[model samples]
Target: MSALTMPLAVRVIRAEHDALAAMLRTLPLLLAAQRLALVPPDFGALRAMLFYVDEFPERLHHKKESELLFPKLRALVPGLRGTLDDLEMDHAQGERAIRELQHSLLAWEQMGESRRDKFEQQLRVYSTRYLRHMKREETEILPHAVRHFSADDWAELDEAFGGHQDPLAPRAGQAVDEAYAPLRQRILAELPAPFGWGPALGA
Candidate 1:
């Protein structure tokens, strides 16, 4: 699509959704690796990944939407109140869910393999909630904004989303969140090759 067609903010938001979806797809592998011991779970890598979930998407992305995008949209289209409220609730719940997952990660790391089932279940729940949340934003909210919001609105949204100064050096031409760089590296280094950054077993 042309630049005139898709607002930069929407593009950025969609990028985040895609990134989170990729991460969520890893959940099964992550949990299975932990449960079956097919490969030893790198609790440190797991923690780092979860920290990215909490810090970047949950905190930065959602905060931008809730604080800036949603409020502006609410004023532009009053009918969006219910959907906006639901989305906001999802954001809040996501924070709590991340905390639960963090706690589970710590417990498993420190105490051995006691709450594996609980951790897996919580991971699945959080993933499902997050996927659903993003789906709503994509299907219901973004299209509405594109339709109802003005050019000025789009400009402001793009500026707000794009203006954040990433605190880390750009890697592969894209800015990586500073805190997540190590986590990204760890995922590459520890996980199996092709899909993972690390070497394959018995290689």
Candidate 2:
């Protein structure tokens, strides 16, 4: 197949989707560690990861897709309104899922053993839901956007998506984004060499 000449927004969204999917895949490992009582779950690392999810994707990525990209795509593509609406609804549901997962994590951390199972269950559910949502957008919505959205539309969308700072999740003053900076360092320090943050393999 020929390579797609995709909009900048499409490329950025796809990269973010892959990264978040990797995090979702790692959650089960964390849960297993907690259950086996082997290498204890790094609650701090997990918390940082979850916070990053909330701040970046749930806050910034999905909002831009729903409010800006999706609307434009629906207008340009015939018979896309239903699919676009479904994706928008998924974004709303995903946000609620994240909030619930956050509460469960806090309870697990503070209340301890009693909340373990509940936290794990919520985490798994949220991961599954989010992964499914992202996959649908990747397979269905992104293709439609790439095919139908005008160059001018892509240009504007690309510029908005390519902002240096997250449009929705900015930090206080000149400080780094709370959810990303420390979390990234924590991931690098806490995770093993392969899993830790840093340059990708053979980079």
Candidate 3:
């Protein structure tokens, strides 16, 4: 096949898709340090970071695809039947993970060091497991989607997501530069040397 021309939705989705993975890799380390190490975490900063990583980027960006992209794909490829069901279930599973970890986020953020340690352990395990789920969607599912979705389909999907409020928007003026600055730089640097839409993005 000729070089894949990513519609704007694909382009933005791919960025978010990889960005969430990159954040997942670092979050465990952040929690690990919060526990065994003596440094005190700024709950505000950590919460801000997670807001973007967990909610804004992944839940918002990827979920929009399920709401928007899958319907178009199903129209194009009847063989893709049940794909949306599986994708929706996967998203629910991810939300379940978030629900389970919700208390831990509060504990780590609100309580003192003692509670932080306990919360850290639980959060790390949950994050590591969640990363595996993300990998399945990115590799097994997203590439197959790119293969069949047309430029017009992608354009409509892009418009759909554009209207949705970004979950991280509330923190953009404050937490973005202070809390997530390092992470944003780290992700751009750590992306796989050969990365892009289609096969180049870890297909």
Per-candidate clashes, comma-separated: 1, 0, 0
lDDT of 3 by residue, 1-203 (tens): 32256555555555555555555666555445544655565565555555555666557765676777766667766766775677667676766666656667787556655676566676677667657656666676667777887667666776865554432232223344455455554443433333211122222
Q: Enumerate residue pairs that collide in model 2.
A: none
Q: Write the residue-wise lDDT of candidate 2 on 50-74 in tens digits.
A: 7778888988888888789888877
TM-score of each: 0.84, 0.83, 0.66
Worst 10 residues of 1 by lDDT: 164-173
lDDT (10s digit) by residue, model 1, range 104-182: 8888788876866677778888888889999999998998888888888888888987765322213235666665566
Candidate 2 lands at a TM-score of 0.83
Candidate 3: list runs displaced more than 4 Å: 1-4, 34-36, 78-83, 161-203
Worst 10 residues of 3 by lDDT: 194-203
Number of residue pairs clashing in candidate 3, backbone atoms closer than 3 angstroms, sequence gap of 3 or more or interchain: 0
Error of 1 at 72 (Å): 1.8
Off by over 4 Å in 1: 1-4, 165-172, 177-180, 190-203
